[model samples]
Target: MQIQDLPYPDPGVPDVRSGPRFLWWLGRNQLGGQLTSLAWGLLHFMAVSAQPFCVGFAIEAVIDRSGARLALAGGLMALFGAATALGDTFLHRTAVTNWITAAARVQQLLARKASQLGSALSRRVAAGEVVAVSTGDVEKIGWFVEGVSRFSAAALTVVFVCVGLVVYQPALGIVVALGVPVVAFAALPLLPRATRRADVQREKAGRATELASDTVAGLRVLRGIGGEELFLDRYRRASQEVRQAAVSSARMWSLISAIQVLLPGLLLIAVVFYGVHLAREGRISVGELVTVYSSVMVLMYPLRHFEEIAMAYSFSRPSAKRAARVLSLERATDAAGSRAADLPSGDLYDPATGLLAPAARLTAVVCGDPDAAGRLAERLGGHPSEDGPSVLLGGVPLDELPLEGARTAVLVQDKDPVLLSGSLRDLLDVPASGEVGPTEALAAAQCADVLDALVQGSLDAGSPMDAHITERGRSLSGGQRQRLALARSLFTDPEVLVLDEPTSAVDSHTEARIAEGLREIRTGRTTILFTSSPLLLDRADRVVLVHDGVAVAVGVHRELLHTEPRYRAVVTRETEEETARGGVLKELHALGDAERLGDNERQEIEESA
Candidate 1:
């Protein structure tokens, strides 16, 4: 397919069982592009081979002083040169198109999988590994794909030249043809070593990349905890390991390259020597001998195709494997059947945790282990459950519902939410049947400061809503980004809102305001909150204490605090911080208004918030 055709109308289901199979699938899809590239490549190589034959004929004609023959030979040479130029130009264009199209297809596949996986994406794959797969891995796969036609044409050219030489001078031709295989196979033994090293380098590089991404993502936290140097040192060591592996890989490839060059040069020398012997014996005409020698020399250039194809496969194999792994990741389940077309309205129930959010009520879930809380929150949102009871909405299996349908019925804002790079308005853009406007969602999420910070960060802007946000809102402060993420989720206004520690990064005062706003905004809607914050818990219609991985207690927030020791312990700790937070928050307000807080200054309040 051509670039003009653009993102494939349908990327089609991929054959992701194995790397080579995936590569074969890509080639199959781009057959038109590959065939066109192959045809052009053949013409280019044919013209290249014709040049040596023309030169041999021209030399013979000059010796005979045949004017007509000389003229014809010179004309043929010019014609071939023109044909070579045309063929080379088109060959490059078609090859490039094939590369771009193939990469685009892989990109589409990755994107589709990523969207299907949603919040579970980071859980399945490292952020760095995903980045590497999408960027470097994709490019390598494309490079190999584009090289396929060129390599095929080159190999065919070598065969054709060898056959022509055999017809022109059989004895010398046989030797040259046999030597071609020796030159091509000489590097085979070294390839295994080189490929292994390459795999090592790629693995090390992926780790380093993942480490760097984690370091950058948590730079704010590291600085807060005075662990910048610690992380920096770790990254330095990782990067050194990556560098060392790369050097080892390069050394092996260099050896292979040396062998490739050395063996081909020896073949050239052997052919020339043998041709001279033939000339002396008068076994072949001088013209034919010249043609044979030149053909072998030309053959050397095309024979390198074998070496190139091997190297391309070596590098691309791992890349395709990574891409395949990404593509093959099945969503929690095949998009459950029978989507809730018009937002299924009912109580949200999790049979595994035995946690239930009655319709039109705000239920708080308190988990001692935050990790457990996150998992439970995901399950509440109908994120794949391979075994055990499925989350049910309106008595239907939430896991059995289509992805879009489940998303419409229940929306979960994770503990750590990301804001994609775009304008403020664009960031909040979501499919919500709710009547809540941007202003309402922003107010409910307590995002006034977030809007102010984004407005100041934007280059060209009107209202704060029109301001642009950087990728993942990195330019924004922790609290600002958190509030913005909340605002985006609130705007969606789904039937059931599952918020896992949504206000963990904001201050106590801000969190209080958010709790108040959320209660008002979500009136008569099922809202499931997973957090340990007392201020948020105080507002829940009912609270469920999750201890040792199961729901052990369910009651009002105050009753649980007065009764359950485990619940009281977690809640009281936040209570102490909340008291101190009041004074600090007042001082913060005295310095300036909330609007004065830039996105960068909004620190994450604390971990256990």
Candidate 2:
């Protein structure tokens, strides 16, 4: 495909059977591009090789004292020069195009897989490994992909030159041809050692990346617990291990590079020594000797591609394997049951937890165990569990619906929903029913303060909606990020919106406002909030108190608080939860407010809280 046609309409289904198979599949898919590049490579290398022959002919013409033949030889040399320049330019263009398109295809496949797996991706793969695969591994795979066609052309050029030499002069030609194979395959024995070292380096690098990512994600927590040095030391050790592995890998590759250089140089020396002897004995003409020597020199150019091909394959093989492993991951819901023909429109019933969230109403579930609450949210969104049957909606199993269907029917926003880096408008621009606007969703999620912070923090002083958010929304406070995530979820306007502790980070006043806004915005739609805060529970149309993964009481917030002791205990404990936010959180919240407030005002807000 043309470069303009890239990012492809489809990357096509990949062969995840093995790494080598997947690499082969990528090459097969881009056969047209590869052929185009190969054609250019052939033209370029042929022109280059023909120049040495032209030079030899020029020497012969001069030695014969023929002026006309010399001019013709000069003209042919210029013609080959022009062809070489033209072919080289186009060859580079096509090769780069192949590389970029190959990388884009892999990126698309990885992104599609990540979407399919959702939160489960983190469970199956290390965050660092995923990051490494998507970034470093992609480039390596693309490098091998783009190099393959060039390597083929180079190999063909070497063979063509070898044959030309054998026909032109047999005595010296035979010697050169015999030496070519040895030079080409000289480093093959060391390749396994080099490849193994590269694999070790990649593995250690991935581990270091994962450790660094985890440490950064929990930096605040580590600092709070006075464990920052502990993690720092761990990360330091990981980084050192990565460095050591990289050094070891580099040594092996260096040895291979040395062998490649030394063997080719030795071949050149042997050719020169034998060619001089033949010329002195008058076995070949002066011009024929020049031609033979130049032919061997020109042959060295294509011979380098041999080592390059080996190196590219060594690095890309493991990278392709990692990408293949991730792509091979199947969503649990896919194998749970057969596809449901229609979207279910009714209560979400989890038989495992014995909980029912009626349709077209807001239901609040207060699960004592946070883990159980998360699992329930997962099941409600069609994530299968080996513990029990899949959740049902409208008497149809949720797992029976296709992944996209299930996602459309049920949207679950976990307690710590991630915020991808982008403009505020882009973050809210998700796949939705188009029933909710950004303004309304922001209002419903009580994100006015967040909007203000984003605008105030903008260095460009441009549109507030265009303000850039840092990766993971680190620029915003925990509460602000939470509200922003909630706003994004609200904007989707799904059939069923499951929010787990959506307002946990915000203060009680903000939480109460959010609870009321959620009730108003989610009216006439199925909404389930897994929260213990009385503020959120009071706003629910019906409340279910879950104990030990089962619904033990069902009533309004006030009714259950008075009638059920377990419910009362959970609700009262919310006060202690509020108080626990006083120590380090007080400082964190104060620092967040300090971005938009004066010191005295921030201090007052913190004191009042």
Q: What is the TM-score of each candidate against the true structure?
A: 0.91, 0.84
The lDDT for every candidate, in the order shown, is: 0.85, 0.87
lDDT of model 1 at position 24: 97
- Report the Cα RMSD per candidate: 9.6, 10.4
Taking the tens digit of each residue's C-alpha lDDT, what string does model 1 give over 1-609? 779988888899999999999999999988888889999999999998988899889888988989999999999999999999999999999999999998999999999888888888887789999999999999999989989999999988888888887787789889877888788788898888888998898999999999999999898889889999999999999999999999998888888888888987888888788888888988877777778777777776667777788888889999999899988887665475665455567888877878878999999999988888888887877775566677888888876778888878889998899888889888877798668898999999888877778778886899888899888888888888888888888888888999999988899999999999999999988899988898999999999998887789999998987556678767776565654454455566767754576655544432222
Clashing pairs in 1: 477-599
Across 392-414, the per-residue lDDT of candidate 2 in tens digits comes to: 88888877888888888999998
- Tell me the lDDT of model 2 at 110: 97
Displacement of the residue 399 alpha carbon in candidate 2, Å: 4.4
